[model samples]
Target: MTEDNGGWIVFQRRFDGSTDFYRNWTAYTNGFGDIDAEFYLGNQIIFEITKDENVELRVDLVDKTGESGYAKYSYFSISGPEDFYRLYVNGYSGNAGDSLMYHSGQRFTTFDEDNDLLASNNCAEMYHGAWWYQSCHHSNLNGEYGNDDYGSGPNWYHWRGHYYALNSTRMMIRVRRY
Candidate 1:
């Protein structure tokens, strides 16, 4: 419900058996904040928690499937942060091929044209044309080099300007607090 230091977001829900079965309540982050925690109910009214102790957000899904279909269950969760976390599906009981697909965690930060092309301990830089030695430095771009041409680098870059020029091979850079 709140964003503290732009760090965390929380969501919660409770059911008092006021609605009918077969209804579903889905939640999504809208690509705004990182997910810190989660919980859900099993078919047999079991309580389940899905999140590490130190996450930033928590989601809970209470499955109150009354005399409905065969309790068909499906859920999806994702996070965007600096580090990576393991993905668990179907109570971590199903095989990888049978369970839903999970993607690697992504970290995103605002593009700083002044810092994008400059090399630093956290970023790398590459040139598209001419191989200008000064342009190859990391700290020059301030971490915002999207192209190889002049007037502020390319229109699209990735991995902190590690790659350049090619349409599809651009790097996908992300930012996170140190």
Candidate 2:
């Protein structure tokens, strides 16, 4: 396993039906790197891909901890892979309910599960990013992860520091990217 100068971590499998990460025979990266691409799993995701194309890999986050820290916001944000970029959330997609999509305001709410995640304070909206912000579990006025003494939220109005702190409101965006 080796790290390229551009910070792209790649993993490949030498044989099928192999689960030994060290023996799977592959490459790796290390140190400071740009998180250009990643995914938003409702839990933690730490794995390497070795020689595969379009295979459905599933990760479950049933009451997981460590990397996820608190279990509020989105859940998890990863900085790897390629072609995955800035996330845009949409809350208005569901009806009056605690839909993971509606409350959390995420584009991809779930990952190969029976249902998506519910309202997340850690990874909620654009403020949380792929990883959680600094401070507390609740995003503050500065859009950081803290109380900031303002309130514990039900906070709406994603202004400068606040990305999606609306009043339990749903956000729907329709912008084309290239």
Candidate 3:
């Protein structure tokens, strides 16, 4: 990741939704200075930026084949001459149901209900509701350890991950100097 004129940071993410190969994406900032891009996908990549102090960027992926796989998400935090931005990347597996949360600092912006939110003004909120709820393993008892509410109703809270349990959650935070 590189910084442009002012304090803009640019990063990229590989776009290979249909294929199996790991594609490599690139990001570049403009001369004016600003966070050019945070997360890039599809033909037209999207960028999320914020001026706040606390915000988050949420991402959800859907796998139709039911095959277990993993993907990588990357971001670059750029700043001015005195301070430099950092690159943060994490690996997320493509399961039936998986949710990944990233905290882009309090100064960043947050995503809204729609997945097509903008990150330039504040933090952009990107949600994969269709994919997130459909892919994971759900139970009525919220996927609790010894709860008998298994399969009783829709398990909207329970999520399968390393922690294991109904409260299993994932979050990422990216700090950039502005």
Candidate 4:
């Protein structure tokens, strides 16, 4: 888990996600500056979106050079815990149904809906982050886990490392800051 100078758990589940969490977030979404500026390659990225948060992470694809919300139709499989309440503490509040939605199509309620209410809906980079449900596991999948490769070399996140291809989307990660 990535912690702030205050020693609070700011990010986790993956190092790359905790490392570049805010940099890639605002860089692609252009949400906040002071919050985004706080994060360095090794520092934790902190943002104040709500008093009670349990955000869900979204992994998708986008152009190498583009803004947020540019996902392709290609299917990919990701694993996560099916139960979020397991991670909850006192006052840790959020939707109870998000754990199941994380494995299927989006809820389409505005930008982010039932699935991951706070999902970035973009493709920034790998191991992208969001306030996932307390139970979303990284490997023990509860739903579909897609496996497709558009590039060669090594394997990661179930896809070959091909970040961008013309208008075609490249594999990337994004966090849904609540």
What would the per-residue lDDT of candidate 2 be over residues 115-157, giving only the tens digit for each residue?
Answer: 1233344332333222222222232211222222242322222
CA deviation > 4 Å runs, candidate 2: 1-41, 44-131, 136-149, 156-165, 169-177
Residue 1, model 3: Cα distance from true site in angstroms: 27
TM-score of each: 0.16, 0.19, 0.22, 0.19
**Candidate 1 — number of clashing residue pairs?**
26
Top-TM-score structure, candidate number = 3
How high a TM-score does candidate 1 get? 0.16
| Tens digits of lDDT, candidate 4, 1-178 | 1311121232222211222222332232232223232222211122222113343333222222533231221222232223211121122112211222332432111112123433444211222232222222121111111222231111121222322222122122223232
**The 10-residue segment with the lowest total lDDT in model 1:** 166-175
Give the C-alpha miss distance for residue 75 in model 3, angstroms.
14
Mark the regions of model 4 whose C-alpha exceeds 4 Å error after superposition.
Answer: 1-34, 38-62, 70-100, 103-178
Q: Which ten residues in a row have the lowest lDDT in candidate 3?
A: 122-131
Report the number of clashing residue pairs per model: 26, 20, 20, 15
Better of 1 and 2 by TM-score: 2
* Residue 138 displacement (Å), model 2: 9.1
Evaluate all candidate structures by whole-model CA lDDT and list the values in order.
0.22, 0.22, 0.24, 0.23
Candidate 1 CA-lDDT value: 0.22
